[model samples]
Target: MVDLRALFSSNDPVGSAEAFTNRQNQWGLVATAIEDHLRHIADPGFNVEDLETSRNNVVHFHGVGGVGKSTLLRKIEASLTAADQRPTQ
Candidate 1:
């Protein structure tokens, strides 16, 4: 598991981003809820071959500041960007 205490304890945003990126380097479940939500948004059905049939293309995560909201957004951005670049079967 990621030492979230250490991750969010960074002195700056750059350090925080670096720590967030390295979180998956270790074992353990940290933010399954956030991860699962990101995966659900990246579903092929949402961005399938028929753009006209697509429902929603955007998702919003709302909460008070300093509550790991930015962290979740950055993680999801990385996750979805990687997924979009992958070769399909």
Candidate 2:
């Protein structure tokens, strides 16, 4: 988790912005279950290798609305970006 309070300052807006950008690029926040689930699905052992192979590198998350779907996608995107992996559109 990030301490947004630390981002506020009476001075040094440039410095704060830089720090925030750096933290955004790095995985400074704690891991959430969504990230763990993505990693697990990517791992061949978690789901059968055959099943994953059949899917041809695809995964989907289905849930009711207002259940953090966008948040989950953003977290996954951040994780992939941190790992230098591009998320498919």
Candidate 3:
């Protein structure tokens, strides 16, 4: 798993964003994908304890009209489909 403490605990917001985006916690199916990506790094201690964590299932956003929220969601859906990512969020 990725170490997020350094990113959030740091002073730079932009760097934090970069680190966060680069590190995504995917579990169940998404976690499976993560495991696949990290298969090469397989250590005997790969318990993946972080994957056991739960997150809110909701996607929250607030914006003015015609802000492409639907479009953005659709794009996300398409990518998930391509990745065969089942919703466990």
Of candidate 3, the 10-residue stretch with the lowest lDDT total is 18-27
Model 3: per-residue Cα lDDT over 1-89, one tens digit each:
54556544655433322332322322244446445656734757555565775533354544443334444445456665745664432
Question: What local lDDT does model 2 show for residue 49?
Answer: 42
Model 1: weakest 10-residue lDDT segment is 21-30
Candidate 2 or 1, higher lDDT? 1
lDDT of residue 58 for candidate 1: 43
Q: What lDDT does each candidate get?
A: 0.51, 0.48, 0.46
What TM-score does structure 3 among the candidates reach? 0.30
Model 1, which residues run further than 4 Å from truth?
Answer: 1-54, 83-89
The residue-by-residue lDDT of candidate 2 on 1-89, one tens digit each, is: 43445434333233322332333322333345446657868776765645534543345565444334455556668656845566554
RMSD of candidate 2 to the truth, in angstroms, is 11.2
Per-model tally of clashing residue pairs:
1, 0, 2
What are the candidates' C-alpha RMSDs? Answer: 9.6, 11.2, 14.3
Candidate 1, residues 1-89: lDDT per residue as tens digits? 55657645764444444433443522123355546657866887554466566353345565433445567555555655677674342
Clash-forming residue pairs, model 3: 26-31, 27-31
Residue 85 Cα positional deviation in candidate 2, in Å, after optimal superposition: 11
